[model samples]
Target: MELQHREIPVEFLQRLPDGIKIVKRHGKEFMVVEQVLGPGGENLMSDAVHIHGEPSIRLGVRINGQEGLIFVDAFWGGHAKLYSFVPDLAGAAAEVDAFVPETRASLMVNRACDVDGCDCTRSIVLTLPDGKSRVYVCARFGCPGHAIEIADLPPTVSQTISSINFFGVGGSEDDWLDQF
Candidate 1:
């Protein structure tokens, strides 16, 4: 199936529970996508923003950075928070997890801030169920903390390829993720 993308703006977010926070001190919302861990990961397709953990079934959110995979051990409760460059929120809705690795991610991306438009660029290497790793580039942007998933999904593009880089923070297979 061809990977499709959708863009949700900060001005169009829905209301969470009574006391749920949705924004960061800096105030920047990003298109966030999550995959739930399977016995070892998260239920990515389901937005368990409120209930994000299954201690017996730990899920993780691994950001593909310039250096390598930065895996964060996510939980289902306690200290739930979000970070952003926009300043207007106490914190955004996110799964409660004990951030692992305890280090900053190395993101050598072409990030920019525009008045009405912006698209960050990067490449990702996704390992499929079969242990076969394929690169993916997010084609669009999504709202952080929202759960919208497409599973058992195959790389719509790239053949006999090494890597691919994608545009937009949400990913859309438009970029190439490579290593050679």
Candidate 2:
């Protein structure tokens, strides 16, 4: 898959949410999640596990009946993840139940994914520092479906940002970051 670099919407930049920030790499700008919270307000960013030189969003996950931790890349539209244990199933077959590692509060929500060919009905919701904004990720393993909702920004801007897939569809594990 080819790498895609989406331009950040100017409107989003003017009113950037609290937990998200932009960083430049090789003269290119990229959005990164600085902080995220669980439903119970538990901090999800872990400095111990970094991805692309930024702290990863840590979550406890139960996949295929096995429980473990998942450290997800903090980069906006980036789906790179490090799993503590190998999952026995893949794709739509592997259902994930995510939670706060500290509070054990579920991050799951009953929201259908908008990605084509993905029939996932649940998502892992991560609340931004502002509380009103949220990042929703598909709970189906290997599904690259996510959406962002910012209270102060227009839906179109959020949708455009959500459509960005830096490593391309289903190619989150690619080493595109190393090239930068």
Candidate 3:
């Protein structure tokens, strides 16, 4: 089935996880997934890991332009979780995550972008004044890039950031993808 006017295919729905669905509002396309839950049975979105799940982690499939660019915004959890097993979803999948530098503008050591089917670790870090910074894109050109954010960085990175005294870092090891 196709959405009104946009003619964008709806079959992509079959490619996503159970809790995720797509919707169009005001001519823009968006994917909406239920917020994940925390270990204590609390709404993690309201406590820690705010705005990192659900509609925040959008799955964008190209409508016409390049024909297969699947763009997913930065999300919490490991990139492996983001890489779905769905077939025929073409084009490169671009994902972004956040990271915090230990020192001012310190060079980020090379780490492979962990998004499934991707192997790039090089990234361009954009540091903010409050240490809430983001890595814009993959260092490699054209392939899908993983955006590294403190909210979404792997557990090891999160632990490291907290150890260094970065501000506004939260997301327990027990954070559930269903708590959004």
Count clashes in each candidate, considering only residues at least 3 apart in sequence or on different chains: 30, 0, 17
Question: Residue by residue across 24-94, what tens digits does model 3's lDDT show?
Answer: 54565544334422222222122222243433322222221322212233232222122222333243543
lDDT of 2 by residue, 18-62 (tens): 999999977789999999998878899999999989999999999
Per-prediction TM-score, please? 0.21, 0.94, 0.26
List model 1 lDDT by residue over 140-166, tens digit each.
Answer: 222221111123333221221112111
lDDT of each: 0.24, 0.88, 0.33
Q: Which candidate leads in TM-score?
A: 2
The candidate 3 region of ten consecutive residues with least summed lDDT is 160-169
Q: What order do candidates take by TM-score, descending?
A: 2, 3, 1
**Which ranges in model 2 have alpha carbons more than 4 Å from their true place?**
90-92, 169-172
TM-score of 1: 0.21
Looking at candidate 2, what is the lDDT of residue 103?
Answer: 77
RMSD of 2: 1.6
Winner by lDDT: 2
lDDT for 67 in candidate 1 is 19
